[model samples]
Target: MAPGGNRGWLLRLVIAFSFAQGAVSMARPAVSYRALALGADERAIGVIAGVYALLPLFAAVPLGRRTDHGRCAPLLPVGVVLISGGCAMSGIANSLWGMAVWSGVMGLGHLCFVIGAQSLVARQSAPHEQDRNFGHFTIGASLGQLVGPIAAGALIGGRDMAGTSAFALLVAGAGGAVALTSLWHIESRTTSKSREEQGERVPVRRILRARGVPAGIFISLAVLSATDILTAYLPVVGEHRGIAPSVIGLLLSLRAAASIACRLVLTPLLRLLGRTLLLTVTCLLAALLCAGIAL
Candidate 1:
């Protein structure tokens, strides 16, 4: 850790990310509900949800490419703007098409922010410290995931479907704004030249073929997909089971908190089992948990 590197940035990043992520999480369900209220069928809701992911899919790699060569801090503010605007606009939009557009914007914003933020982390941390730092960084996301829906559930309701939905979106926008606080001092001029040279266009295929790259990518993809499906579909399960939204939120938060706890103690765990064994064991446990959820 460098000077002022006593995990202070990590903490600030997590806190900022929590608020930003919380807003998005809160807004997502609200969007789904609001869409339903506006007469969107399950298929329509699915389409809208898919749109959020779809729009971002094309942008992720390019954004990553850019961040590799440029300042990560710029993307933070830009992402905040997009997220806030998207959430707020989605609320106000009277038509499904309008909602879809804004949702795409929100997704794009998220992609930008994530690319930038991840790049920042990679740039900032020492090699030996990367794993712990990255683990700590994601805790912010987990925290946001835990809090966002609860906030949404609290703010949205009362049969005034449109009204409540609008409120939720507006609130999400405000939450996006909260991420701005972390934007301060995010970029460092010192590392600019080194990063630019390193980020220079390299063959994507070459990078992918590098040692550990394939495995790492696969693991990340699998884990993220599992988590995504879990988050998206869990509420539907709850709805069918007649669980309250607040209860569902709490349950999800419990899971997230547990994950945070895991990360907090990741160093000890890693030391105990080492990386390969640790990943295998935890991922296997996660598989079992997913199965349990499905059951």
Candidate 2:
């Protein structure tokens, strides 16, 4: 929608997303390491990590509904502020509860950023263009996931675990703020929103009843939860085994790199094996690898 249908906006959006997502990716492991240094048991660690997800579950629907009616740019800055504040505060928080509270705030900020970003993509693209644009947009997330853990590892895993981890978190806060640099003029004021949709919202029951919907949701949940579990707990596992944080970060980067590679080849793989077969094979492989990691 630029003067010549330029996609400069998409590139800037991707850059902003990379920084935002990088901060979160870095913060998650730093939080775990930081919690461990605070004398938190694995139980406490789980509680703190889980809180990062809990608030977002309750907040996303309302936030989405709100974004549906308003400009998406506002949420981006708000989200950045929350993410930055939460990361910085968590670094300084001495108490377990304080860390948990800040973690939840970061999670909510993440949800806000993602929903707003995705909605902007949807609203800006035509139906025929949505697939390509969305694909390009998700590449930002992959880039962040690939880089963030390495940076965190470089900063953490010192003899002063508490201090080093806190420093990493502070750095992540600064990284998140960098996203604000690209957010200017992100939403076009000329874009109108007063028009109504063509139809009423579909009933939840009907959506649930649709063939493949529940199954697809379950598959996505399984995949995403596995990644989250690794991000939050791998450092703990590394600690138990006396593994270096840098090594753990390398492992995570490897995981992310594989994910990006798979996405790059997804279309060709889909064509070669078809969806059901690809799903089964990928799930089986993932289960085996996960079991190996456990051992």
Candidate 3:
């Protein structure tokens, strides 16, 4: 089927993605809170947070290569399983070390899901439709990010810090599993990877030097790093200041809501300012705002 023919699969994909991402999002802060309850010092908490990024670092290329050669649909389930297992296991873990390990597994699962999702988007979409499809996909992610923190905030926090946070993690696991329901038959059978894609690997350096590639990568990395830092440390900051978990969650959700608003307005904004200036202005504003938050 042509990419423009039916968009129902896209909606389903977004819903499933939201659930998976929400599970991860909720687990992030809950992990931090639970770590604190497990007698973690600042350094230990830092290590655990860093683990999420580091664990997925080396696995990207391999997973991408696999998707290039095989099917993308299978990776979605693998991701859901890993995410669910990580969240549930982390809840039961008694030590920072165990939490770190599970956190890595969780990160890997997320990487798998993203790789699969992106691959599916490329395979199933015509070039003209690619931009809109990607935008829609990002909205799904934003929805999860926006809701997850609020849910975490509501479920965590109380006299029994460890117990409450663990409960939240368990809940996240169940939420992740819910995504499985929407995963059935999302990928088009005819959209399998082309023989050309299955052949030789593109030279990474050549691709990186292509027009707009480096800048796009930089922007994506910058934005992602900022959000990851927020998810990892915001709750810790709240804990230190004696802030309520629900309040912290609200703050995080607002950030996510702003992200969604930006995505919605992006097309018109791009037409007005053009891509370069739009990116420049937005990045500057983000830098200033994030710095203010840090202070």
Candidate 1, 123-233: lDDT as tens digits: 777788887788878877887887887887777666686688689889999988988887666554324435636845887899899999999989998897787666656
Candidate 2 global CA lDDT score: 0.87
Pick the winner on lDDT between candidates 1 and 2: 2
Alpha-carbon runs more than 4 Å astray in model 3: 188-190, 197-200
Clashes of each: 0, 0, 0
Q: What lDDT would candidate 1 get against the real structure? A: 0.77
TM-scores of the models, in the given order? 0.85, 0.94, 0.93
Candidate 3 per-residue C-alpha lDDT over 184-289 given as tens digits, one digit per residue, 9 for 90 to 100: 7776433575667577877778888899999898899999888888888888888889999899889989988998888778889999999999989999999999
lDDT of 2 by residue, 11-40 (tens): 888998899999998899999999999999
lDDT of 3 at 100: 97
Clashing pairs in 2: none
Minimal lDDT window, size 10, model 2: 189-198
Quote model 1's TM-score: 0.85
Winner on TM-score (1 vs 2): 2
Flag regions of model 1 displaced more than 4 Å. 1-12, 126-132, 188-191, 194-200
Q: What is the lDDT of residue 235 in candidate 1?
A: 58
